[model samples]
Target: MTAPEDHDYDVIISGASVAGSAAAIMLARRGARVALLERRSDPAAHKVLCTHYLQPCSYPVLDELGLVPALEKAGAVRNEARWYTRWGWIEPKAAPSGPELPYAYNIRRSTLDPMIRSHASGTPGVDLLAGHAVTGVIREAGRTVGVHATGPDGPTELRARLVVGADGKDSPVARFAGIPAKSHENERFSYFAHFRNLPLRDGITHSWFLEPDVAYAMPNDDGVTVVAVIPDKKRLPAFREDLEGAYLDFVRALPDGPAIDAAERITKITGTVNYPLHSRRAGAPGVALIGDAALTSDPLWGVGVGWALQSAQWLAEAVAPALTGRGDVDRALTAYARRHRRGLAGHQHLAADYAKARPFNPFERLMFSAAARDAGMARHMHLFASRIIGPLRFLNPVALARASAVNLRHRGGPSPAPVHLPHPTP
Candidate 1:
């Protein structure tokens, strides 16, 4: 599986996490040489601050990797989320497994990251370098050609037809390639802790959009519930004053006493003031960026994990022919860059707007209120919330008309009667 004694590798990926591992695994399986780099030598370490809820959009990719059964056996749930909107809880029925999407996964990064990396390491033609930290991208005539990295053995240079930046937001590869990442001023901060023995609501994750504050309870594998609270910057003082007390009160004050009230937190309450929100252009002459290196939006929605896997899938599909020596590398890189924008630009614009911490606008009020009254309305709204569709599609003219009709029907009733949502359609 060596690179024909010409190039040191077909691709040298600069992170061994989700995006990097995914790219390496797929590229190597396609018979291209790959060097997967990770800063940490230990495979079992986990990212403590993530919500760790994988969207159903990524189910097919996990299935392709043959990790679906393993993930389920290891306690990954078939994830479906509930939105506590201003009107009421907009809960869609769980997505049924079919020929396309299998199911979503809810598992800790400690369990999931290592599992993916292990699969990448075992795939033939992949050189999994666990402790390699990429120092800079090697450029040849204004094109990225390799990487200069510091590993356990001091320093090494890995040459490749393409170098990929799968590193997180502050990606050195993107930096070295001079890809300017545009970001916004974040007006909110988030804090979270893991609690065991918390009762899940129908085994689905719940997100409460409480004005300027957002809170979520995501049930993960091994009976652990991750409770996260994101509040406006205005409330940082209270949390800074009493981290644990403020966090506990926030979760307990939800309309009903959620499971966190009875359950005990097993991990320390962790938080961050500067949760980054941004995007880079996604490619250079001989390089491409995947995952957070390319774009990371509002964590309040928790699409990062799914998008990470998806960007890798897109990169592999766009560049597979080039990696196998059948097409132009620059052309493949351009295809990936174009695909990145096509798939994510509109979505990122909406996320950047919401990250401003503004309360519900008129459109949200219309959608949320109408969604609770009609079974069909909630289903489409759920698709948008689940990242299955974009905002524009969800709030199209046709949908707005339906929302108006639902409101008219509600108005016809006498003084706020209990309007039940119709039995959910199959």
Candidate 2:
């Protein structure tokens, strides 16, 4: 039955994944009623096509939600990220390591999603409608007011003052609200699996960029390493012909890899043969988008999880006044859109550029070469890689000067750091 013209919730968020759940918790904490609709009813159902590495940038948001303690208690590891370039590992020198959320969490999405959803469901003003599939958006005078969905029993119309699409890359809510995302050529396809007994740094996450091709061996909470490879589309034929062999060959070729080759895969080798990259403006009248619905960058960088939770928090802060009727909703939506662009547009542009599967640009050559030679430069760059700061700040004059000096110091010679992969932690 139709729930009439007025809204039953202050916000109706489609998709109860990371972005949706985070927003639900934030809004409910602010005294706004939220309806979190999830198509899958099972508490254990999870997003399988993900590496699920949350960058350090997401730590503050997790802390605000009081989730870090819980996640750590559940075996989440806090490790600094280290990258392998053609030269050597561009490892950051240790900063004054206090309890300042210095490391990132690598957990299975199957586990991470359920934990987040459980908290959102338990929040005071949140109504979690499990198994409710959003089918359409309800409109009045050309403004989005809510969503129409089918529950377990029958069709239902759920209205709200604001609608958020967090349903992923191909968001139905974004489509129904007529918010189009700008998509670009996707030059890569990826495959990954969780494996047992893979050698890992107890406190260091690893990424090896063999330029156009990238690989990862990350230690997750359950004592398994999530090994993944993103190869250019030109390699698709080989992957399709022999996914297992091709996948192993790619990972084996990483500068810091082949460790995953020895470990036994505990889960099926799962992945997307062709994953497209999409970027949306993410805000409109009475509606907004978060997570992949807002902007899906190349998975090679693994920014999705952090960005998902971060975007939700950003939107909640921007729209809190509007949801509570203290400020104009239209202005609030515009503010959210502006902040979204401010936060991600530069980062997304570079992500799209790299997704082209081309060799490093001159800027990258300077940056990587510099980062490899100089620890100070590498630490500053880490601010960018772990997403603590955006591109512009990372590329400031201080970093550029160090890179120039490093290039001159070697006079074009390659820079490879001292050997040190940590012994396994007890």
Position 108, candidate 1: lDDT: 91
lDDT of all predictions: 0.82, 0.83
lDDT of 1 at 344: 84
| Per-candidate count of clashing residue pairs (backbone under 3 Å) | 0, 0
Q: Give the per-residue lDDT of model 1 (tens digit) for 1-426.
A: 224356798899999988899989888888789999998899885566677988877877888788998898999877777777556677665345523322487889989998999999999999999889999888878888899999999999889888999999888899988999999867779998998888876877888887777888888899888889888887787778888878777777775436676787898999898786889988889889999999988888888888889899999988888789656888988989999898888889888888888887778778887887787787777677667777789889999999989878888554432222121112
lDDT of 2: 0.83
Cα-based lDDT at residue 13, candidate 1 = 96
Residues 217-328 of candidate 2: C-alpha lDDT, one tens digit per residue: 7788878778888777778887788888777767765655747657889988888877778988778988999999999988888889999999999999989877875467
Model 2 misses residue 8 by how many Å?
Answer: 0.5
Evaluate model 2: give its TM-score.
0.93
Model 2 weakest 10-residue run by lDDT: 417-426
Q: List the residue pairs that clash in candidate 2.
A: none
lDDT top scorer: 2
What is the Cα-based lDDT of residue 382 in candidate 2?
77
